[model samples]
Target: MTTLPDGLHDFLAEAGWAGGTIEPLPGDASFRRYFRLRDGERRAMLMHAPPPHEDPVPFLDVAAWLTANGMRAPAIHHAEPEAGWVLLEDFGDDRMRDWLDARPGDERAAYEAAVDALVQLHRLPPGPFAPYDMDAYLREVRLFTEWYAPAMGLTVDEAGHEAAWREALEPLLARQEPGVTVLRDYHAENIMLLDGRSGGPQGLIDFQDALVGHPAYDLVSLLQDARRDVSAALEAAMLDRYAAATGAQDDFRADYARLGAQRNAKIVGIFTRLAKRDRKPRYLAMIPRVWEAMERDLAHPALAPVARWFDANIPGDVRRAQGGKIA
Candidate 1:
């Protein structure tokens, strides 16, 4: 029996869920919290995203758009966005990461379905969302210098870093097509595997920060997951599958690589910030995995400029170290 706020209790009661059991679920990196509610045979998920630090409007809007578009975002049963509480359809506990951990043999099939979902999603025009443009890209990549570099006790060439990222990213941005809806966090953990759904269409979650961006962005997020290992062979095969399906073989690889490097750099900074500023040190352990994925992406020719910047700024020892810890 977890203690909840008076506002949440009133919201649930107004939604006809009074006297239900409230079970708090594990939280994620954001300021949001979730709980499971039960009344008789009924079950619903409660998303408590308090304002000032978090907002539920974007999540509610995106969920509606996805469900309306015939995708698998959790159906919103009830919502009071001003109060930062949303009651949602329960897409039970089978996250893609946990599911794969139990059935390693199902990896390929599961990933194929995931890729197909992305194909379906990319076909839809982007919703009302901000563009993941040059300023956005630069702001995200600078997290490395702003947080991770200082935390690692290393002073880096901030000017060179920006120049390198510009050289690598501008070309990709220049030739961008009509952008697709990019679920900025489309990795395994954020994806759910619903039980008894035929073909196991994934249940999408944690996409409040959706944006209009290159098609390659979400693909990189899925295949180069930070919390888990996606083998090189599987990544290549998936890229091939996406290319074959979409006829985007021309410059997809470069786009994927550049975005991958940028995304991973941002993750490195975020994880460091979480540890340093937010007092959540567990994220520190994931930095090494993120570094490996970033390195793989930086190997692509399109990422040469950024790679050179990293080589000149971040020492090889720090790059290889777990969590980028100096000590």
Candidate 2:
């Protein structure tokens, strides 16, 4: 059995979960670790986020906001913010990705439900979160030059790259609609398929990094998933659904395309950093898909400036030069 972290045993015991069996759960690309605590028929998820690395307050606040707004976020049964531990409601093992894999026929329904959940979330008043503004956006994409470029044995002119990105992204940012609460990682893995739920079928997790951003941001994250394949047809259908539901059809496609490009660019850099710096090479395998998605997003006329910058800098050859195979 996996040894529980110090203080966790006593914490659970104090919370009436004494003598429960603890089993480690799969983690994401963050400092947080999850474990399943079971005591007879009762079960809860324990989140261990080491201090100085992560804080549980944002997650707790967001969960309460989501729940208050009639959305499905895990309930915080208990919390120890200073110690970075939280006991959350168990949403079960039905992560959307794994569930969809087992039932391919339900893909469309699952995606539609996910979109429905987003529609409900967008209806809620915006929360107090940092804006995903241009500065933040630029800072995130800089990870490309900072990490990926070096890994590819290429030299990056930081000033020149930033200038190009700024010129390319300025107009796009100006054209976006007002911001909303954007769950930064709204992909399939972080979404749970909970049936018979009042709020929605999707149970949200991993949303501590939520930000106020263009409504299209989470849509881009969902449709242009970095680690999974979402069919073009399904993506289009969901986009239509979201646009119609939220009355954001005006310039919606342009916004989607622009945000998709921005998001994929950021992911490439993040994945590269994860592989090289964090020593998690598994993320490297997802780069080609991200690059492919970025290329597709760049095909939109609205992304011309960004596309031109990418063509001049990263280019196809360097992007596809992985595993000795050209993508």
Candidate 3:
């Protein structure tokens, strides 16, 4: 089991959260650590990060920016700069996954709420927020070819397949879309359903690392989830729904499908790496779900060529690893 610094208990004692128990929370990619501490309605979170590995500074800066721009983020109360620990406002206990999984009939309604929230988030003006440029995005996408292929003991056909992936992505990059802050992890897990709303306003955890990216990126994140399964018909309907909501051109569906291919490709490599490099095996199970979404998305008209490539080149095993029963 992973752990925080030795003085963590002493530190919590000093924060008036003494009676609260400490339970370590599961993390995805970052080096930061989280703990759920509570005694009652007075719930709060503790974050720990070490230098070079993680830093809460950007999170602080962005949280203020998001607050000013009308988003509900964890309110910071106390902090120790040298120690990398902060006490934050509790968003309470409703993970969107639990809420949606409990009622599949309510899925579309909740997703619609998420789409509306994405609209508001993307609409934010960008003078204060730093640019999430192509360099960072491209660097992120390359993770599949770099970390993924190596972990799988696969060559990745770097000279060939890598090019295909980029060529497939060029149109998406050319789209030149501007959006407000894009919570790169805008999926069910991070979103919280507050009160009676079907997919209540975002509770917003893990957004300190948000990238200033295309609004559609986040929409892809929510609808074409890597972990949970979203039906193809639902994905299509939601794609159209988002377009109608924003009055965007129907071309949005094509762009959405293409982007789905790009994102899922990166994720395939990522899950392999997570297991091989980080020794975190849980991510391996998510491999196929992401692939399934990619396959369904590639069925779109604009992605016909991409579909052809996967059909011909990306092995049957690749698809199987991506989560299809192959019946």
Candidate 4:
């Protein structure tokens, strides 16, 4: 067993969970780590985010907003922001991925619930999260050149890449409708299915990176997942549902395609960096799926220039030539 940090023990004791047993939970791509705490029949989640690296402020703020808006976010039982320890409500182990794996036939209902949660969230008044504007979008995609390019033993014309991306993406940016709270990572893995929750059936996690952005952004993130395969049929259905529910379906498909490409491009770089720099190669296996999704997004007529750039530089054969291995 991994030894518990002294501070964690102290924090738990201060929070009156002193004798609770700690069991490490599966971690995500971030610096934060989660553990389940059990004291007799009571349970809670402990989030350990080392300071100077990861902060709990955003998670705390977003959780508050989500709960306030009638969505199901984990309640904060105790918080020690300065020490980077937070005790959160245990939403149980019903992550959407695991739930779907166990009941393949229920995929549609699960996705519908997830989409409904988004619809409710979008209805809420916008919060103070940072804008996911063009500058931020461009900044994120640079990871493609910064990490993925270097790992594939290829050189990138950084200036040329950014300029081209700007040209391709600016029009889409200009066409964006008013923004909503975009939970930067709204895919299945971060969503919890609360079987009997009073507010909503879906619970959101991993939203510290939330931003106020184009309403289509989270929808893109949901249907065009990086780590998992979301079928085209389900994706289409969810898009239709969101559009019909929100009445902002005007040019929604175009926005979805544009943002999907941008996001997958960023993921390609991030996953590569995780393997080569962070020494976590498991993320590499998901690259091909992300690349495939990016290709689909680039096929949109609006992305012709971006598509041309990829064709000129990382030809299809060469891009997939890595054969699922980053090293």
Query: TM-scores of all models?
Result: 0.97, 0.94, 0.86, 0.95
Give a tens-digit lDDT track for model 4, residues 1-327: 687765988899899999888999877788889999999999999999878899999999999988888888899999999889999999998888888788778788888888888888888777788878889999998999888877777776788788878887787665544568889899888889887322239889999889888778888888888877899988988899988898965477877888898899999999988888888988888888898889889999877877877777775666666426456
Better of 2 and 4 by TM-score: 4
Q: List the residue pairs that clash in candidate 1.
A: none
lDDT of each: 0.89, 0.82, 0.72, 0.84
Q: Report the error of model 4 at residue 290, Å.
A: 0.5
> Runs in model 4 with CA error above 4 Å?
174-177, 196-200, 322-325
Expressed as tens digits, the lDDT of each residue in 95-138 for candidate 3 is: 78888778778898888887888777767775255555656555
Candidate 1 global TM-score: 0.97
lDDT of 2 by residue, 11-38 (tens): 8876778898889987789888999988
Model 1 bad stretches (over 4 Å): 196-199, 322-327
In candidate 2, stretches whose alpha carbon ends up further than 4 angstroms from where it belongs are: 172-178, 196-200, 322-327
- Clash count for candidate 4 is 0
Better of 2 and 3 by lDDT: 2
Report the Cα lDDT for residue 88, model 2.
Answer: 90
